[model samples]
Target: MYQFNFNFEEFLAEYWQKKPTIIKGGFKNFVDPISPDELAGLAMEDEVDSRYIAQHDDEWDVKHGPLTFDDVPEDHWSFIVQAANHWHEGAAQLITPFRQLPNWLMDDLMISYSTPGGGVGPHIDQYDVFITQGSGKRHWRVGPKREDYEEEFRHPALRQIKSFEPIIDDVLEPGDILYIPPGFPHDGYAIETSMSFSVGFRSPKKQELLSSFADHVIANEIGDVHYHNPDLPARQCSGAILDAERQGLENMLRSLLDHPQLMKDWMGEHLSNNRHELDLIAAEPQWENSEVREFLTQPEVLKRLNGLRAFYYPETPTVAYIHGERFTLPSECEQVIPLLCDHEEVTGEMLGEMIEHPAVIDFLTQLINQGYWYPAE
Candidate 1:
């Protein structure tokens, strides 16, 4: 039971939802999730989403990914990579430690390496991001949450500005962390050759939130309540029949939504679900379920998956939802769910404590049955 030595608990208590706070040199011996060469290598891949912003002479040039510096004019552009979290094992590891929340509530990390005068311009992201200054220096300008959000059609020649104004501006050295809440407009430019790791938490929008739930219902994983059509004949005319049907459908949906567990179900499925483009690195000859259980039973051995994160949406008092493998867990062991979620070191001591609860042990046993749980090398 190694608690985080960092003041995350104090931070969550004081300023999580309040104004943004800066932690001067918060990360100690913080290594860049990946090196510039590694990022460049990933950018050269055709499938990954990467971009570069060439901003000089008051003009901007932007290009999409699987690109190298040779792909663009190599003067003043900075490399911006998306879904870097998915491709790079280290970038993914950077975020796994923060799996206190559900996976659905979590999002991917983006990283960039920039030359002098390179920047993406002032932009507002739809989700939250924790920008870490990895190497060199970047000047970050931040603004407050603005009103009057403007949506443009994204003209090819025009610069798109999201709602953000510069309220705070400073130079970020290595290990300096900048936390930006959603809808806060901010911009960063490199003072020199700088690298930044953006750890983001992208919560769902209204449409996405609704669609995810709808998809889950259609999949028949949750909301077992049947949409019973009243077996009444067409006594009324066409107009009356349409109105009655609408009312019945609406009422049925409302009833399903009215359950106290509806939100929990949605959160669970969302958080515990796997990320896109999962790269499962297998080891040695495949072992059977029996071997998996035997491996898990070892007192000194620990079972952890490489490049995998497990998060639980622990909303209900009786059960929890784990991401990646997608399974239910005992609510009593909620205190330990994050250990698995972070994809960090998991100790036999922690498992022993959790297995003390018969239900939790049973659930983990089922995971072993599925070969999702593996012993650490």
Candidate 2:
């Protein structure tokens, strides 16, 4: 377990999305869980998403990876690997401490290793991120939220912005954490070889929501009602749509909200969908009831797959959404739903009482067989 030194409620009320702040020694005596070599190793895998960025004076270069060491130069370069938690167990463990936030909004863990003077140029992110220093030191400069700025594309794959006046500038050491809210421009350059882990939270854009909702409506064949105006009032111009006509159109779009369950279902499914490719392997020789029961008797650890999204809506209390699929839980297992959704790892002893319920056993078996959840070792 990681020991968090900051005040949770105070931080949420004061700084969450309001501004950027650095918490020194957030995890006291923090030891890095994953090494730089291991991070580089994962970046070489074809399924993993990785990027190599190098700076040569004013000219910047970026390359997508499944890259070997020979492809990356030793100096003036940085290697970034996305969804590290999905493929590395140590990186997945970092997500446990951030459960204070909503589980649905929690994104995957991204790890980056940088050589001296290596950094992604100044840029703005649309989501909240808590970046923790894993090893060595990094100098971070963060500017306030601003919409007016010049964006530069030195490399097609990299989008950077003109330098801005920084409100917070400091060097972060291992165990230190820096929280930057959405729209804040920031940059971090390593002073030496170092590793950093980022735990990010998702914030859906209005346009993205509109597109997704439109797709859902179209796929379900919803909103079939056509325009019906029984009492036609004469208009000065045929081209001009009157207030009544505009209101009717608006209401037609709003009709999708008339079914609360439909909205909840769509939101649940959308939010529970994985943002990155996952590393998964189906269980071999699926366990039978007896085998499952016997397995549950021993002390074993069950872990959720990295990058797997799982959430439950309060409106539909009995249903839990995992990887865009909904599972109905029995009343007996309803109490354990939070345990399943929030934690990355759960021990057999923790679930010992619930194992007797057939519904719970079946759900666990299905999850294991489908490769969503499995024994840690």
Give candidate 2 regions above 4 Å deviation: 232-240, 347-349
TM-score of each predicted structure versus truth: 0.75, 0.93
Q: For residues 157-212, what per-residue lDDT tens digits would candidate 2 score against the true structure?
A: 87799999999999999999999999999999999988888999987888878898
Best by lDDT: 2
Ten contiguous residues minimizing lDDT sum, candidate 1: 316-325
Candidate-wise lDDT, in order: 0.67, 0.86
Candidate 1 stretches greater than 4 Å from native: 1-6, 56-58, 71-74, 83-89, 96-104, 149-159, 162-165, 221-249, 259-266, 281-284, 297-309, 313-343, 347-349, 353-377
lDDT of 1 at 302: 48
What lDDT does model 2 reach?
A: 0.86
Which whole-number lDDT from 0 to 100 does residue 214 have in model 2? 86
Please estimate how well model 1 matches the true structure, expressed as its whole-model Cα lDDT: 0.67
